[model samples]
Target: MNDDSRKAGGADQDPFFMRDPEKLAANLARTIEEAGKAAGFWSRARESGMVSDSSFDPFADMLRVFSALGQYWFSEPSRSFEAQTRLFTAYMGVWMRSMQELTGQAEPDKPEAKRPDKRFHDPEWVQNPFFSSLRQIYEVTARWAEELVERADTLDDLTRLKARFYVRQIIDAMAPTNFVVTNPAVLRETLKSNGDNLVRGMQMFAEDLREGGGIPRLRQSDLGAFEVGENLATTPGKVVARNDLAEIIQYAPSTGKVLKRPLLIVPPWINKFYILDLNEKRSFIRWAVSQGHTVFVISWANPDERHRDKDWDAYIGEGIEFALDTIKARTGEDEVNAIGYCVGGTLLSAALALMAETGDQRIASATLLTTQVDFADAGDLKVFIDEEQLQALEEAMERKGYLEGGRIAMAFNMLRARDLIWPYVVNNYMRGEPPLPFDMLYWNSDSTNLAAANHSYYLRNCYLENNLARGRAELRGRKLRLSSVKIPIFNLATADDHIAPALSVYNGSRLFGGPVEFVLSGSGHIAGVVNPPAQRKYRYWIGEVHEEGFERWLETAEETEGSWWPHWQQWIEAQGNETVAARSFGPDEEALDDAPGKYVRKRV
Candidate 1:
């Protein structure tokens, strides 16, 4: 890092850039020398009529299928003349667009004119004629490839899914912005730094190659900007209870007279729980405390091979079940208001159903944020799920008895490539600049691993089979059903959420046999939930509870100006009448430290 940034330090104190000028300079020299060779290769490739980004060959995708089949001699792919014809037509269309571009009268991409894809939203993309044409034609080609694969008659669903997966991956990889020669931003950065950026980008790439097994996940220096308890999850709280399965945290109440019923937050174990409890400015935990509600959250164990056998039954039994018990015991309340985010909400729903079946009516109400119990339309994530894919994932997990965190992260990141993936590539690898320290992103890069059996069970039962929505899912030998959940449900779905897909969350709420007040937040998964009134950022919509679907609700629902947290507080507060004095914090044991807790610091 530069001398100034080096002293900026870790998350303990506020730090910004995690860059070193000297190392960056040395790395850029070597990077430029290699890039010189790659540029030569690109010139030759251009002469050969291979117009594309990426240092590697791009045309292999069409014929790449043949190479795969040839490698597996015994395997055969059914021929589809129609599929071939469609692809040929797509190529011809691309050529026509290219010809138009040469004549300086490129036909406007009509489909995109109606509704443009945000993937190429950068002003520089269209600001340059060459880049604009490249982007338009590339997108046209990508859409065609994805559609044709989806409509392929000869390919099995799994094969087709995998093909589409590869198609998107290839398209994302080939974006003009990825190359320094093509990207204006990178070019400017290169010029400004006088080759330092190039050196830093190469060093970053090499470091990623060494540490990430070829895929650079996060800027390590940027990640070092924030420590868990000190900066990120710095809310005042105590690990009131801990178990082998999870850590139950009860945040100190900010109010004098708190709600009679404690609020229990069940965050998705796919991620750490601190997402809802990050910095105090945006912390839902701190917000809840300030709203006069005693908040409790589950800090899931970062599972390793030793915890491989843990399954659906175990998560339902030991995860939420244990948290509920601990919250009830500690708060001296028989029943508590439960809140779940993403998969944590899903698990909480399952546990609540199991509790209902067994006559444990300990939950007075439930709130689900960007979570779905129904997986009938689980969005793009379904592409990586099914018997075939699950088997493949299982085999991979078998190697370590746990699903690799990065591999799992890839599927989610793919959902919004432009937002999650590419910006990092440009910033860290292209500009030789590290990320600006942001709390939400810090929590995002800080990922946790998943157990083999638990993940498999979740996929097979939830995503692949759609058992949870059907009310046929079973946990711990008990027939579980969302219909069994009778608590007043506060269902929050983000309008722009790619992960939960507001519609899916809306669909899941229908399975519940209770009065569910559905609220549609303004943005995607994390931002939608992290909406604080202070920012006045995105607006949310809320409709009357009815049988109509999401689209209909959007048409008729009332739009609200700011954050939905206040609305939620009003709704939740109405659930109970009396209030009691706030309770104290801290666990009886010594291991678990302040707010963020030790479990969050446990990285895989």
Candidate 2:
């Protein structure tokens, strides 16, 4: 038997190998022999199926043959041939060394010498007469097939006799490059505009290629600091309350007596809360402020190892609970509207559940954006949540005391390997492109680590067991059930979202026994929420609340187009008082400078 086959067996005995050698060898031989037989059979079958004197188009056949040859040459196996050869040689050497050690023939502590260098140019092993003859035969056959394909004249002849063989090769040769169809004049103008710029771009791409890969530049010209209009009146806004980890930033109308209640915005700790209040034109928070409604947003403190034991419960207790009481103290109101995004929404749901169990109906309304409650259908995250993978992750986090943001980013990148990995590799390394500076990519790269305890618990309980969906998730010895929360809910989901698929986000509606307005928006997870009114490309779908299963709701829901944000704004406004007011839920603290507080400046 061949060496590759002979070495395939008893791989389990050697954990690394994990296969049987003799069986593997036999299989390989059988496969090669069968492939040869199949090729011959197909050739005969084709001849038998065709009528005699069938128009033989040698040109078309030649093209097919050449294309096939090119394809074979450029395929993954061919590209990786040298690397695979080196890997196999190294593996064999390691195995030999291991066996020698086991037999007491080699000293365990002795390091082996470096392997001798070998080159494909050498005429040692490959100089065999048998191999030379086989190589000649292969070349001749390939050439003859190519000549046959290329000689074909008619399209019909090519299609019937030679198209399949050559088409694949043509595709392979053209595959790596991206092509955009446009007017020839426009294309030519674009190419000629700046030769120097093109040269520089190519050089930069080459540099990136050498470095490994390049990141795509996200459009950031439209993004900047918040800009409030001159006509917009400034209001009396303050930090109505401060907690152990956060401060509530509240804004109210400057000219009027305040409404009794207020709106509370809960943003995910993963990013700064400023996303809602980005600028005058796009800021949803600022828009709410302009509408004269009382607004209070939770600013989460940046955490470190000192906060290692802080879990979901602490977030609810010190974060949301603290803010709720502070708002109450400022306004003297028992209930207020709450809006939560992503992880914040998750925590809000839990808090609402806890409050319901204790008969505390303090939440007048609830809005969840891109939040997940039922993790059973959490989508792409499923790849990394298996028991063994989780255990390995836990061990890794245990070593570091926390899970680094970089590790989390890596996991996310894996989900979109082609877009995230391959494009970068080709652009940076092969095409020689420069690094593109993009704010979105920058923020995405700016990851925050998760505490070991919190991460482990979240993965095991929420993701693996789907505990929240099953009503088995517990916090602080209190059973947290989604059904307990009966408040009016506005749930927003995004199409083209990778993190939370729209259907999965709709699960929140089923989990909560309340009036639900499921709104589907255009764009991805982040962009969908950050969508400004001026952008014309986006659209949304509004579905009536259905108490039935997520699948059933989808079946019954009608499709619509346009931004869901407007619908959301209208719905949320309807639930609250329409009159203008300078409202505060609790007593104000010492004045804080602006909307985005100190917590946002903290490094992730």
Candidate 3:
């Protein structure tokens, strides 16, 4: 606990360290050397375009942001002076507080004044004077840097977003908790284990680097704890059909009789479809079946170079349309209810427009879960959609034919790096502990690749150009318009969603020509939509859709406790409540595979 004790390698406190410091030191040195070699290999691979996507240098953008900030501040001498004085004043306050603490003259910080940070939850961070001061300094510096960006009024909206985002990244990366010596939890573990934790951690670091094929894929959950069909995606079903882009999985009937209009689920291709079917307890597909709805899900293929030419047209034609045709063939049904999650909903909306143009009316109703048809109010994800980044991304996809799943996974993880990236970094690499087995995290880790043409078109039309909402989007040489799609829509948006902001989803709801019932749910992108009624977690809002604005709608909306599953089921049944005998896959339509088809099983 003292300087001398620390300098003596905490040997007096650690029996293992006191007994054999030399052996521990030797092992630490060797492991660190091996880790260095692995890091060197990763660096080389990134340089050679094996790990990284393309020449999209994020650092260049960061520099541009700072340059704008510098120019704005320096434009006026008073402004520059004020900025410096403000930062220094904050530092002075920190120093004064630390002095007071050391002299035992400090009053306890008010609970309201004490900003709760999960990273500094360890008692030592508050109890130890040095760590307490260190935390205050980090907080001060981070706030100052963020304020600099916020005050840079000269920067454009996109540039400001990028600056804020990049600054947060830097501040988070520099946090004391990330480092071993500064992190009391890791330090205690290290001293207790006599440096053995470091050795094991470095070994894992090297192994993960190797597994990633030059990129360090941090394990967010115990990889061996769950498998696709065994425990995770265990819903009973049969793969009724397969094509170039997807497999249509029709789940077995849980009830003797099912709804007349079957339900089809289209999940985002960015990740596997099993998020909705993680287990019996949380499986939406199973829940739907139990509620007397015959469910069919589209399991998109994990693409490769061969799929590089596959564009939006290919996805709509082979994925959505193909599933539609298969669903009709399997069940002697002419119409069906459909649900699309995230980007899949975007694609489905486009397909519906195309179907409208061509007078195809098989889809009776649609449920969009955390989906964004209009990207104007899209959140932090918009930071990655500018022209420069798109070109760089396109170049990378051009070389690889398909964008790697790991790259997509990394981008989403980076959006919430504090929760997703750094905690795993400190636990896996510093404390030397494997992540707990979380089915949601496991599903997140299991990402899927995107074809070059598909990803490019999506970025350009949806995020970059905002063409989908603008009615300028085209699919397969036909102009697609959301207004043309007249089917009733159940639009669900999560209050805390980062990928698809609720406001954006609300804005998108107005674009539909038919009656749109916009529902707001608690939690985020994944949890909000996958919520089953039995859990009794999170709430949902329902009321008349206010076309004016989301705030106006919320003002009149009635909030309900528990999941929105029952509400959704009621809506779907209201459309066509007829009862039919539970149907099985026809003998003509032979089973391609078991439920959670082979396509979902493919890993990048």
TM per prediction? 0.80, 0.60, 0.95
Winner by lDDT? 3
Candidate 1 clashing pairs, residues 3+ apart or interchain: 1-19, 1-20, 2-19, 2-20, 27-199, 28-198, 28-199, 268-344
Candidate 1 structure lDDT: 0.75
How many clashes does the backbone of model 3 have? 0
Model 3 lDDT per residue over 335-418, tens place = 999999999999999999999999999999999999999999898888788898889989988987998888778889988899
lDDT of 1 by residue, 430-518 (tens): 78887788777777767778998899888988999988888788876788888888889999999888889988998888888888989
Q: Which stretches of candidate 2 lie above 4 Å from their native place? A: 1-244, 252-260, 420-439, 547-560, 578-580, 583-589
Which scores higher on TM-score, 1 or 3? 3
Alpha-carbon deviation at 365 in model 2, angstroms: 1.2
Candidate 2 lDDT over 1-604, as tens digits, reads 2234535754433222314446545544644454454345435534664211123223444555445544543465644464445445655664565566556687442211352212111231133222223233333344443443453333343242334333423432232222211112222222333222233334443332222222222211222321222112123355655655677877755436544557788888666576676545656776666655578889876666666677787878888888888878767778888999987887788888888888888888999999888886677666456565677677666654666554466557655554554444434422334447544444554456676776777778777888877888888788889997888899888887878888788876788977888887888888888776666558777767665755676677666565566677678767865453465334544566554555555543
99 in model 1: Cα distance from truth in Å?
8.6
Task: Flag regions of model 3 displaced more than 4 Å.
Answer: 1-21, 43-49, 52-54, 108-115, 585-589
